[model samples]
Target: MEMNSSNLWVFIETNEKGQAHNVGLELLNPGHSLSRAQGDEVVAIVIGQHTEAAVASAEAYGSDRIIIVEGEEYARYSTDAFAYAFHALITKYAPTSILIGATDLGRDLAPRLACRLKTGLTADCTELDFDEESGNIAWTRPAFGGNLMARILCPNHRPQIGTVRPAVFKKPEQDTSHKAEIVREEIHFSIENIRTKLIEEILDADNETIDLEGAEIIVSGGRGVGGPDGFKVIQQLADALGGTVGASRVAVDSGWISSAHQVGQTGKTVRPRIYIACGISGAIQHLAAMSSSDTIIAINTDPEAPIFKIADYGIVGDLFKVIPEFIALIDEQILTMAV
Candidate 1:
């Protein structure tokens, strides 16, 4: 199938209740910016049942056009069904670029879509930019355990595809006053065409884990922190800074922190404004996750810790002593401001 359209397309992921996920909005920030730079429009494609609210949210997030495909079969994401529907839409609209969130579902679905479209896809990208000279996208991601950054480009593909880590890009501010044309499309695929069978969907009770990717500030701990008790100080520091707590792979493997807080090559990739590392040695895997932070502060007793190489500010001291003092100062500052 040949596509004749030339717009930027974004895939919108919605919950069971058809509420748009924040990651979709996050992708829209770059999508809209890229569209404007390319002199094209931002088109969002959402697939699910009762997607009116999702379509509305996409428009609020800066989509110039919303394509809603409604069907009960799409209520739960099935790779085969989703790929078929999205493939059809791509053929019809002919977009210049396609962007998806690097979430669990997106990680599973995007590669399948790329295979279906016979195009290359750059996954877990930390940065995205338009090459004005070539009119192509420059997708950058960690190559060798976060030691090197690789920029990828798909020259021959009509619709270049890229999947970005969640929370790497700032979510576009909502423009409720800005409206776009909503096109309700039909999902013509039948149940027989779907390959996967739906089993029981069990919702976890403890889903309140902090999402580090979306966190503006993250304070992470590493082996230098010693034991699980050290996380108490780290958590207090995060609380004082009004940020979330993160951990290195060693901390997570040692059961010092939940896997949810782990940030590294095998864990989540974060691009917060401020990433404070306490007792972290700055392993390449750990750096791969947060080297893109706007400001990086490292605190380790060892002056030669690998983390100091990339840290904008390196503090050589015991985290137990340093973290408490920093928290106290922050508290005092807050009180001073109130006074």
Candidate 2:
């Protein structure tokens, strides 16, 4: 493969309806920052049918150029098909670095592409930076069960690859006025080359909703919440704050709440403006998800809870007493504002 130009490449993920995911925009913020610092263009690679909307959305979020691969196989996410398409692009236009979201599809495809190109890939990265002097990328991720941060460097690889967890970075401000060049590429391989067969995809009717990953405010609970009845107080608090309710893994595992509301390394990573951890002990896994929150409030009986370390506000008291009083205060404040 001959390289004509070296730029940063970001893999944009689209939903079933061909709409771009929020994480795709989130990557653009850091991607554009790196591109500006390194004097390289940020090229987004979007694979799917009818991806012009996706491209436009990518451009709105600071993509300098967009490479679109359109085909039926590209519509449905297949690990082999996506890897082949991405590999083809890598061969055609060699990039300085490749970034992908640490979603289910990205987790499956990035490693395969790395293996095919014989390049090093850092997974679940929390931070990325380029060494100006050496022009090498430094990928930072949590290691040893999230106890320590490890910075990885791939000195020999042409395109340093990394996968970042969702919500780890802020979404770039939309620049609709910024124009971007769109490049369309055809999928050379046929259905025969694609070994995997697509079975029927079953989507739950109730599963279609806004996820907490992109939510601005999240009110979460933990084991100190007591039981299912305790969730009422959390719900009231969330309603007062105009935010969604989330739960720690302990709360979910104990049947205090559904797993969908769980926030942790094993659940979902959320970067919100406010993350209130009510009656929750902060485990390393739990911290992995909401540590990126702008403001964290920890309200628990134990003053020594680990969550207080990262919390912007630490309230040492029973949540049962704290929540109602907090809600009343907020209500009164709202009423005063109305006056």
Per-candidate TM-scores read 0.91, 0.95
C-alpha displacement of 300 in model 2, angstroms?
Answer: 0.5
Which regions of candidate 1 deviate over 4 angstroms?
Answer: 1-4, 198-206, 335-339
Error in Å for residue 169 of model 2: 1.2
Top-scoring candidate (lDDT): 2
Which candidate number has the best TM-score? Answer: 2
Residues 1-339 of candidate 1 have per-residue lDDT tens digits of 233278998899988789887778889999988888988888889999778888888998889888889898887888888888999888878789999998888998999989888998999888899988788999998877676899989989878999988767778999999898778778667878788887787653434668787788999999987889989999999988889999999999998887878898788888899999999998998887788899999999999999999999978999988888898899899999999
Error of 1 at 227 (Å): 2.4
TM-score of 2: 0.95
List model 2 lDDT by residue over 220-264, tens digit each: 999999999999999899989989899999998998877778898
**Worst window of 10 by summed lDDT in candidate 1:** 200-209
Computed on alpha carbons, the lDDT of every model, listed in order, comes to 0.87, 0.88
